[model samples]
Target: MNGKETYDKLKEMAFGEGIDLFRIADADCFLDSEYEGNRPQDFLEDVRSVIIIGSVVPNGVVDPLPKGRSQYTNTLMAATALLRVASFKLARFIERTGHWASIVPNEGSEFGYWYADKDTLRADLSVKWAAYCAGMGNYGINQLLITPEYGPRVRLTAILTDMVLDYDGKSMPLISDACGDCRRCIQVCPVQAIHEDGTFERFKCKEYMFSELGGLRCGLCLKVCPPGSGNP
Candidate 1:
């Protein structure tokens, strides 16, 4: 099969496997001079595309936040778990198609993320960037990928592959167009971690979750990200 054919098969498999969101991002998007984060080429020199997959974090999960945080944390873990399993199958399928594939870890929004660089707290490469390039969603003021279907209430993972799949989409503005001057996320943040300028202090958010919340994930920034529209 060709690039488009392979992409369709992979999309079918991903969506059939219960992945609520799927997109193919031309790996070239990672080479942008503006993206200072790690690159997929660093891990796979021949990488040509990225498969972005995810499931929405049901509104139910976010509604009880700042209260049932333990449950909220576990629910996010559950979504990550689902993504990992589906990603494994997708990676194998891509490899069987005569191409190499690497699954990017979905460590964001987890408790005590072991895979992230401790000092920087970033994943090996930005799956969120790949997702953005694939047009799955756009960034919010809170620095979370806000999908039209679920706003920032989504969990995502990605597969870096050498297969030259048809790039289904192109990158847009770093932040969502709908993210106007709404600073609700910044206001609700207990640690003042989120900023109005679309930047944030990772350590501040991390410390608040780890030090004060006793390791339960904080969802305040997520809670006020005006669902779907991205503005309050």
Candidate 2:
């Protein structure tokens, strides 16, 4: 099947399984790795499209907890489960149709087949960013993708495939700035990691995550987010 047909089939399968899948050409930011030498070509030789999937974590699943317990972990696990199943099904479908496909987990030593560079030490840009680039949702001030219906409460996964897919390029530009100059997330940040320029201090965020603050990996920014403020 052609790109569009392939994308349609994937989308149908994803939605059928309660997941949202967005299709974009490999040119999207997620697929481009020129800045970090993490290009997609290093992995799948015939990669023609990326299937970005997003699962909204219900607000109820985001309870703030002490250091040892993480609601983020729980939400991520839930999202991962959905993505894994959907990805497996999609991969099988593609293989049955005579194309190569694979499901790349968000966490791993390599991005598909590309090995990490020693000096850079950068994992693929956050999967959320990939979903954003695929036109799945808007990027919130908290550096999270905020969907119109789910706000900043979502997890993302990606599937790499050789199947060419039609590009929607239908991004929600109007959903820009759900934060809206509001520094609630910044204000709530105990470490003041969020800067006025919209940049975050990675070191500071990391410190809080590992510190004895007795919080679940510092999800204050996420918990305070009014959007998607329910159980996952």
User: Which lDDT tens digits does candidate 1 get at residues 25-58?
Assistant: 8888889776778886886789898899988787
Where's the lowest-lDDT run of ten residues in candidate 1?
A: 223-232
Single out the weakest 10-residue window by summed lDDT for candidate 2. Answer: 107-116
lDDT of each: 0.81, 0.61
Model 2 C-alpha lDDT versus the unseen true structure? 0.61
lDDT of 1: 0.81
lDDT of 2 by residue, 50-160 (tens): 677767665555554323245565565667688788888988998899888866565311121123233443444345555555667776666666666666656666777
After superposing candidate 1 on the true structure, give the runs of residues whose Cα lies further than 4 Å from its correct spot.
108-113, 227-232
